[model samples]
Target: MFEQEDALLTIDELCSILMIGRNTAYRLLNSDAIKAFRIGRCWKIPKAAVRDFLEASHTVL
Candidate 1:
């Protein structure tokens, strides 16, 4: 079960959490690398999706 604190977040919230610019966030969303849901005109992203994106995009040097 997911906690309330771990619930889906809005684009702005995700941007703040990821410390990325709005354009970058929008690009990520557009590319579908970060899963998002459209609610009317706003986009919402689950916390788990963010974690998954970070994991999937991680590169080992």
Candidate 2:
């Protein structure tokens, strides 16, 4: 659902959007629990990757 021209998101943005704490988000990103890439010292997480993660980790409710 992310329609920004640039699909990449910073760690802070990811945390804000996902409603998770910084540590949890970093842990997930660092552990490859979600897809992410680095440019210099910053992370660039794709919106699609987050969507995929949620979809894959969702449980029936």
Candidate 3:
């Protein structure tokens, strides 16, 4: 049910979506916690990967 029209998002877009600072996003991108791809000099994150991360990390209080 988490289908998205766009599979990839720019770093800026990812930061906005995750509500994190650019540096934090970069850190996550660098770490294996999140997967990212480089196209030319820019990095792009897959929306599905983000969704999976969220789902896997979710915990009910």
Candidate 4:
């Protein structure tokens, strides 16, 4: 789903990749809709998790 070869992505990177806003990205994280973990005060999202989320979302729709 993403062209960038990053194992972990930051909130801004996630927003850029998904073409979504920071709030929306944070919402997903807070809701556990997209699996992520916090490193100190920063969130680290796995690329595979994002791919899985996209795939699951696509299937649901």
Backbone Cα, N, C clashes tallied per candidate? 0, 0, 0, 0
Best by lDDT: 4
What is the alpha-carbon lDDT for the whole of candidate 3? 0.80
lDDT of 4 by residue, 1-61 (tens): 4666768999998999899999999999999999999999999999989999999999999
Question: Is 1 or 2 the stronger prediction by lDDT?
Answer: 2
* Residues 1-61, model 3: lDDT tens digits: 2365877888888888789999998898888578888889899888887877677668531
RMSD of 3: 2.7
Model 3 CA lDDT for position 43: 91
lDDT of 2 at 29: 92
Q: Extract clashing residue pairs from model 1.
A: none
TM-score of 3: 0.80
Q: What is the lDDT of residue 21 in candidate 1?
A: 92
For each candidate in the order shown, give its overall lDDT on alpha carbons: 0.85, 0.88, 0.80, 0.93
Query: What are the TM-scores, per candidate, against the unseen true structure?
Result: 0.82, 0.85, 0.80, 0.90
**Alpha-carbon shift of residue 33 in model 4 (angstroms):** 0.3
Kindly state the number of residue pairs that clash in model 2. Answer: 0
Residues 1-61, model 2: lDDT tens digits: 3877878888888988889999999899999989999999898999999988888789533
* Clash-forming residue pairs, model 3: none
Cα lDDT of model 1 by residue, 1-61, tens digit? 2356757888788888789999999999999999888889899898899888887878531
